[model samples]
Target: MSNIQAMIVNVRVDNLEASLPLYKELAGDVEVMRFPYEDMNLALVGPFLLISGPHEKHISQHATILVESLPLVVDALAKAGAEIVDEPSEVPNGTRLVARHPDGAVFEYLQPRA
Candidate 1:
């Protein structure tokens, strides 16, 4: 049996305002809530995950999410004007897509193996 559980993942960012738009597109139809934090913000997407503000300290490094389709996401992100840092790569584990937001935050989109 798999010991998997559902919870929320919080990713800290530098600018919440600028980052929310990009995250909104990725979240698709998922309902999201945003909480402003003086200098940063926290975006909650159900019980799945949350993307915080895009601050200087929070830029460059962040967490990742596993999606079912990498190619589709890549295309969508491209259309949204996201900068592709690493193209889709298929490894033994799964496929990975990397990108950087306008504020220089690195994002990893992973499609886990079966």
Candidate 2:
């Protein structure tokens, strides 16, 4: 069975609060998970991961994938010839790592805290 949990698209915004109403309306008023990471403010609004902050500090990953295990993801990515852009580390959400696939697509794999 695949360990992938959920995939979220990353949307960069200049202002999180201003960008949220549209997403919230689209998602039918789903609760937003808001938090801060480094200098960035992040909010999970439905399937969209809204990010607002300095562009330089951002990882520039195309998307975020929630996984069951970061270790397994690391091993699989390594075998698949994916470059580890960022080492596995605990973030505000959980443990995560950024990787660039062989096709040059970047993704953030996160294992949410239990």
Candidate 3:
């Protein structure tokens, strides 16, 4: 079985503050993990990952998945004929890579920094 840790739904918004309250409420008032990546601002509230910024800077990934091992996930994705949308790179919280599966579903896989 895949060593998937947690999966976060990706949500895009024009204004982070305006959209946060609703997501925060739905997430049971969880603490938010906020960070900046490139030209975008991201926030993690429980299972919801909110991203706000220019639309051009955002990739249409279906979800952000927290994984145990990014390298392992990369190897598995290669064997599964998935296309690497973004190479593994350091983000605020960890390293991440975006991949498009054979069926055309795109996802972001993240491995938190040790």
For residues 1-114, write the lDDT of model 3, one tens digit per residue.
777999999999989999988988889958999998788888988999889888785579999999999989988998999999899998878999999999999999999988
Worst 10 residues of 1 by lDDT: 1-10
What is the C-alpha lDDT profile of model 1 across 26-100, one tens digit per residue? 767777765554455567664434445445654344656667677777777878788987778875446876788
What is the lDDT of every predicted structure here?
Answer: 0.62, 0.91, 0.91
Q: lDDT of model 3 at residue 75? A: 88
- Candidate 3 has which clashing residue pairs, if any? none
Give the residue spans of candidate 1 off by over 4 A: 1-60
lDDT per residue as tens, model 2, 28-105: 868899998888889999999898989885568899999998989988998999999999899977999999999999
In the predicted model 1, the residue pairs found to clash are 13-53, 13-54, 13-55, 14-53, 14-54, 14-55, 15-54, 15-55
TM-score of each model, paired residue for residue: 0.45, 0.94, 0.93
Question: 1 or 2: which has the higher lDDT?
Answer: 2
**Candidate order, lDDT descending:** 2, 3, 1
